[model samples]
Target chain A: MLHTLPELVNQRTTLVRRGRFLCVDFRLSVGDVDYDITVNHGRLVGFTSDGGLLRSWRFRIAAPAQTWLAFWQPVPAPGYHDIFALNKSRLARLEGDLYPFMSNLRYFKEVIAIPRDFNFTTEQDLVA
Target chain B: MSASLEPIVGRYLRTTWQQRPVRIYFEEAGNGIPLVCLHTAGCDTSQFRHLMTDPAVTDRFRVIAFDLPWHGKSPPPVGWQDEDYALSTDAYTEIIRTFCRDLELVKPVVMGCSMGGRIVLNLAAHHANEFAALIGLEAADHQTPWYDTEWLNRPDVHGGEVCAGLISGLVAPQSPDEARWETLWQYLQSGPGVFKGDLHFYRADSDYRDRTALIDTAVCPLYLMTGEYDFSCTVEDTTRTGAAIDGAEVVIMGELGHFPMSENPVKFRQYILPVLDEIEKKSAPKS
Candidate 1:
């Protein structure tokens, strides 16, 4: 099963359990910025946010049974040159100066572990 | 029974070490080797909707067209990154390789249009022996100046709008009816940023010239076609682009533009049928 940081500060957070899925909600300091990430059996099944924004990114991680998924918005917009200067001095400065601030932004991970035997009702259930 | 569009469940075929997402669409018929059909950039497998439903194409080859992450039904990669650079190309190439390996597709004929055309070129160049043949229609060459500029990134630029305009112009029932415009508009809305991201990736790419050279040297039979008014890749440019390749065949269809398949289906079929026939003949067992 996958997991996220236990606590998120600078943002209002809520975790609600709906049947077998866990829905984690986040309302960012920036008004109108909110997102809900859904997890099932420790894997990320889907994510929904304002309009088409998060939906686009969510599709990238919704694959492979045991794979881990994470999402975050980079800080200071990483100037245009950073794209071409990844191996140069600009990247070093950006990594040291800006990365830590954005570290707490938001993220998700898919852990590798099968549900206990008790979680299974039958072979058909397991297949389902 | 004939094949239907019901979603088929399958594993994520990792194309590169990075493991990009590749969804495979399967057809029930066909006994010969599978054919990989790569769709244009803006549209997904839907671009080949007509071809997929046609008995001629499907009965002859088990055609498969995958959603490149950030386009069509596929999701965009986590975070915003340049979509046109070598990184994006590498990721896409990996997706194709992985899809073929996981699905056990052997000697598949890789055909693509526009961005899909660029992809087929990359595949043939990097993994020459993986595909049986390569065909590019109005394919964007790497050396083209598409990357060095960002024409679509303007604040007012909306890909959905551009797509709607292009579709309205290309498709018949030629009235500027609101319903048709709205239909195209709705289709464009599903993945706006993804299209923008792909455009960014295209502009950032710097290896088209090198890859084009590699495709020429790979010694694979290459077929290239472009419409009369294809602004993306002119016939002159495409001819010069594939000049280095020993046996690369080139055809320029008249009275057509960027999308000959959509603009002139009859002529498009006339040109492509002979090629398909040739592929089927060669792929047949030797007596």
Candidate 2:
């Protein structure tokens, strides 16, 4: 259905790189709701919405290519939520650091070694 | 009279031209000139089994139905590419050309249903002289944006592939139909991955509308038909499509959806007989 994320509210953002990983900080507000997201590669590692810890996901840098961050959780867990809430000023600062991190992550992956086989595989066969 | 209700299966013709496997089935009695019937996507010539059995139509002319490449009993081409599976009108035109040449049959009245309809329209547009007349049932009209920007955006339980499987279930009859539908579904899922490839092609290809317009301008007379409730190709859509072709005869089967021929055999025969009669009269020898 509507798989794409909604547009970001605040345009100002930043990104920071550490070793083989990059952190993307961005602020997005929809209606009365706002969220501060710190994304690693394509996965959301740390998230705060409305000045509270929304949720954390198990994220690992893929091998070989190491260009992708794989996010996964146990099968029985509830599904991921779309929106989050966060305070205004912290969101602004986080947004500045997050954008550059995402941009740099994309750049490094493009410039350096490519990532391979980043899909999640369950040990238990769901189909069977 | 031709054999009645008895399953008549025989070896007709087989060829491996253009690296594509081809099989042809020839019936005893068909009126007027030879009519080549092309089935829709995913279905074999068996879908036309009822039409083949009807004496009124078969006695008047020779009806030739063949499996399109990689469908039904026809084997896929060696190392077939996904691009080659769902053909453009140009590719279909070539197939008809090759079929006619190999079978040594003159340009006959070409009638097709669904995907078959699309192919015949392409032939009529580009090579009108090769066919006497053309009939299309629920032919695909719009291209890329129509499906991608619109239909593809709609939410479904298992995407378009599963939706197609559901439609097959609806068309199939209950008693013996269950088995047939199951077989078709299995075939669709496992066969050549053509279904997915074709879906993508329909979404990406931009020339479908242009081809419909081209067919409309061709010299040969064109006939368009669709069921009232046909969700795949609606009557309104068919009406708009017919408007593109000058003097194109349009028929809307009331209370009928897609696959009118299969859904209502009696009514399908009633409508088709007159066309066959007219073609027979035209093709008759003059002294």
Q: What is the DockQ of candidate 1?
A: 0.01
Residue-level lDDT tens digits of model 2 in B78-148? 67754445555445566767777777778688888866776666676677887778888766565212122
DockQ of candidate 2, scored on C-alphas against the true complex (2 decimals): 0.02
Please give fnat for model 1.
Answer: 0.00
- Proportion of native contacts kept per candidate: 0.00, 0.00
**Complex DockQ per candidate:** 0.01, 0.02
| Candidate 2 global lDDT | 0.50
TM-score of each: 0.56, 0.57
Cα displacement (angstroms), candidate 1, residue B45, comes to: 0.9
- Across residues B176-242, which tens digit of lDDT does each residue of candidate 1 receive? 2443344354335635554445444455652476666677434556788876555455567678766
> A1-128 in candidate 1: lDDT tens per residue?
11222222102133112112323332111112223444443234443444445432221112111111101111112111111111121221212222111211112211111122124333333223
RMSD of each: 19.4, 16.2
Docking class of 2: incorrect
Return model 2's CA RMSD, one decimal.
16.2
